[model samples]
Target: MGKKRLVSLLLAAVMLLMAACSVNMGEDEPKTTTDPGTKGTETKSGAQKVVFWHAMGGATTKVVDQLVDNFNKSQDKIQVEAVYQGTYDDLLSKLKASMGTSEGPTVVQMYEIGSRFMIDSKLITPMQNFIDQDKWDVGQLEPNISGYYTFDDKLYSMPFNTSNPILYYNKDLFKEAGLDPENPPKTFEELKTAADKISKTGKAVGANFAIYGWFMEQFFANQGAEYVNNGNGRDDLATESLVNSEAGVKVMTWWKDLIDSKAANNLGRKTDDSKKAFSAGQVAMILDSTAALKGLVDGTAGKFEVGTGFLPKPADAKEGGVIVGGASLWMMNNRPDEEQKAAWEFIKFLTSPEQQAFWHINTGYFPITTKAYEQDSVKENLKKFPQFQTAIDQLHNTKLNRATQGAVMGVFPEARQIVEGAIEEVLNNKKTPKAALDDAAKEITSKIQEYNRTVK
Candidate 1:
């Protein structure tokens, strides 16, 4: 053979061997791309983002965002986007519409009581499942607060902004009334007497309160009144509302006398308006949620030293329980496996004690995790600021009372409106407390009955 022909054959043989090797490597490795610029940080889900829906606003949002930022930076697994969806009602509406829809958020912040309905819907995964599946230590959480997102034997959500109401006072007004500013009102009578003295000052209203239904619920629980008939809103089988009972009526009557004797003023009942009234020195003492600490601090802004204490009890009020308030985080139903994994990762990140501490310290949301309270940073913050210390103290010995279990009647918010409307009538001198609550309770019963029928 000629030399040129032999060389050509050898070149073709080498080319064919190389092509065969390429085919085998392609089959074994599938396909993937690595950018040198990405610097070894895996995309985890490759640009996937999680949507978190919450009702937190103002400073609360700032606190939440900081936590979200921390989670994103800690790992690149998934990015979370939080949207303020008005109120819990508005979020419920969106959740109802999103059921089984593909466009909903992976996470939704729900009212603690309303979680019962969500649990029944089977539209979300229980947080306990995640904890166990991931081999998480439940002990890291505060025991009593665990049930905030739980129902029966399963937990459908994770406690986010859990809080309970407490008595907030204007210390300057307390001193003016010859009362010890540090020694706050301890019972309904003490509150009234201090209020009476403050009212006599002509500058301070004796007592201040907001949300009649919330007050009735809190006061009744404080008065040892059963809220639900069977076992005070504990059992799911409860068939009647006991809020219209003798104990309930008595508390309402006392509140009426405050208005009647002109020892107290409603001054228009809203959480914000009430805070403003108290901070501006229009009222001496206000019963509000410890969650209102931020607003109270902001409104006072060095105007007067403020003091905090647990909600006043009656001399005979139940000494052991106050129900939980605030909302929780829920994972929506039927997401893709990847999406579910991503969502669960995000949920775990947010519920961790470190994140809870960050939230509690910054936004006044009670730390859902126990470790947050025990942190040196949290302790330092509490000592540096009495406002923070008060809320912390309230939680130190709180009992998980069923009497204040929380309002779950579907039209509960509307029922509150009914009571507020009746309150207006009394505040306007159009009806007595008996007359007002009578009108209010009747409407509430109808609404409860109406909501009950729909649920069943």
Candidate 2:
């Protein structure tokens, strides 16, 4: 072969390899090319562009993008661009850093646990302000779902990805344990009894729930117990945590007892691990968010029948309820009137029955509106995946109260970690439930005071 010809062949191969590597690298990066005129880093879009910053990725990202596309195509006055802003923590961090600057999104989807911080930021325009100004009828929204974001009797953010923690069981394991598959436990004591029976079968771990703080929050609400003082911090800023109260102790004690008896396996603090155990049929039952319904169904396909019920109560507690979980949509304030109005329009559209129904059917998150259940797609979802209905019924049955409304604290995320650490300590036999919870409460109170001082 001629020397010049050999060199030409090598150059061609090198160019081909570089092109292949570029294509692979693009897959790992976020799709910032959705709208070339404005990159995601810049908070403000063109006059008509409504920059929507979100934390959705993976398969869920497609659903979010589709929703954005539908909203964008439906109107000519406004262009909606959905940007993936990394994980929830990263999104909050970026949002906090970008506040007070023009480099912030007009609309943001924030998680429920970050509600307090969002409220404290003073960077968001309350949804109720726009609803009242426009005379919008918010009667369609599920009161329980919206109740979480309500402050001073006014709704702040529009609930988007609402959910509830529910008890999921494996019917196949129930049958093996000689328990009725149709009737799952309704209380912690009953769950322990049933778990003991299932454990005896040696077919699977009787129960498994992640050592997550959200579950503890639900348990506190179930006992009509507040997670913080001053009416769960609704009346005023919370200076302390009440998660170490007697009611919280009862819930933690029950959880520790289950682990001690070997009836329930401890999955640590990772919710995914617990989900994996349940999906693999290693755990007969699990307590997980309603959002896990679709994933659980797909993960356990052709394996075992999955049954869902409300999160079990404390057996003696009456007139108690579960708090709403999940994220909501907040519109950034100080934007132009047109941008604000467009943001409100997008929020209204997203929470509308039709759109919410579509979102619920696709994402497995509970729809924010009661009317969403009336939509054909949602109705079909209920029929095909009956487990989805459990959360709806639970929400409807929940008692409207301060505790169930959830606590609002600026250091909520930190408080959640403290609570989770307490739960882990009890589950690992490092401390008694009371001791662990009390310590957690003290640590959380200190953190809250620090956070409040800085924010103020």
Candidate 3:
């Protein structure tokens, strides 16, 4: 044959060999099938894998891992992977970055204030959807706790770690100051009196409240005050902030007065510092979440007796109650149907009475289900640390109302920072309580408007 013809035959033979190799490689590859309902790869065991992202850290992380393990072992249909995603703020930022991507979690634990934002983002499948489909009786959940996550008559998230603010005091200091250790202050005026006595007795600074905006919001709810207009954003979208209203002024004024009269210590803005002060016997009282009860009680063991009380309100204020605090589990819309279903199963398991009791005992968070109180572990826990009962009683006593339902705003996180700034200004004598709050309210209103515009 001619040289050109030989070269052409050689090239065609090489092409045929490459095609045969490709076919063999394709056959040798694992035969995999994707579920029509899922965009993810299935496990070899055929179990649907659910990715759970949580903001729990420290000791709580261990409990979360244990619960996930229990769920995985309970059945083999679904295998859940629980990931620690740092603090709530950090987790939220990471989630935002992962939006519209498959890298995001099937279920994410978002802080309570993020409800409005989550709803507005339209990135979540409302927990109510699953509840309705399954005909699940939501009445089993604590109304006060669930109310915070419900909007437009729909529950947007499953409450996991619910809590409320409470007054933590040193019983030893109360006795030393000639105050009734058994009868802790119930109102702001009474708290001031007790604080003054404690200060005068040279026991410790009467009280020290961290400049946490959540505390301000709780105080507003306790006094039947709305943090934002339009029925605390439940009746309709809030058009403006009510943080400078009469109720807001009352809280700020009391906080500032406590500092001015040397009845309380200005511990800046760190709740941790206030907690440390209280545990070390350097402060007679501090305001914190019920979740802090175990730590406070254990930390102060033998140093002093710890007393718990309902969050204090103004003596004349009525028709108010504490709003539920803490985070909830949200099902993401981007996840596949199978994955979402698996996530729902995991959520149910977490909120079940037994699991809730376990979680409540391990972590200081209140069990979202009322039935958890009936669990023997919970009963023994409450009896051992009676301070836990104070939180339960406070939650049950809270009146279900627009104000107590808590405010909803897409800019809630930002709004909280503004309120904290106002508190700092008032405490530092930079502005009067009313003036500072008014300024903060105006800024928050502007932010709300901006958020609304963007979401729209």
What ranking of all candidate models by TM-score puts the best one first?
3, 2, 1
Using alpha carbons, what is the TM-score of model 3? Answer: 0.90
RMSD of each: 18.1, 12.1, 14.7
Checking candidate 2 for backbone clashes, the offending pairs are none
Write the residue-wise lDDT of candidate 3 on 107-162 in tens digits.
Answer: 99988877776776667899999999999899999999899888889999999877
Candidate 2 on 175-196: residue-level lDDT in tens? 9999999999999989999999
- Candidate 3 at 26: error in angstroms? 55
TM-scores for candidates 1 onward, in order: 0.83, 0.89, 0.90
- Model 1 shows how many backbone clashes? 1
Off by over 4 Å in 2: 1-47
Clashing residue pair totals per candidate (backbone < 3 A)? 1, 0, 0
lDDT of each: 0.65, 0.79, 0.82
> Residue 61 CA error for candidate 2 (Å)?
1.0
Q: In model 3, where do residues sit more than 4 Å from their true spots?
A: 1-44
**Model 1 lDDT tens row, 1-456:** 443344233323322332232111000111212211111233356656777877665446656667777777788758777666655555566655564467688888876645545654556777777777889877776655665455565666777777777778888888888889999878778877888888998877987777445666666666656665555434663445565577666776677778777788876755667777888888877877766677687778779988888777777765554556777788766666577667788778877767877887776667877777777878876776677676666666656555544444434455555666766676677886677777777766765565455444
Two-way lDDT contest, 1 vs 2, winner: 2
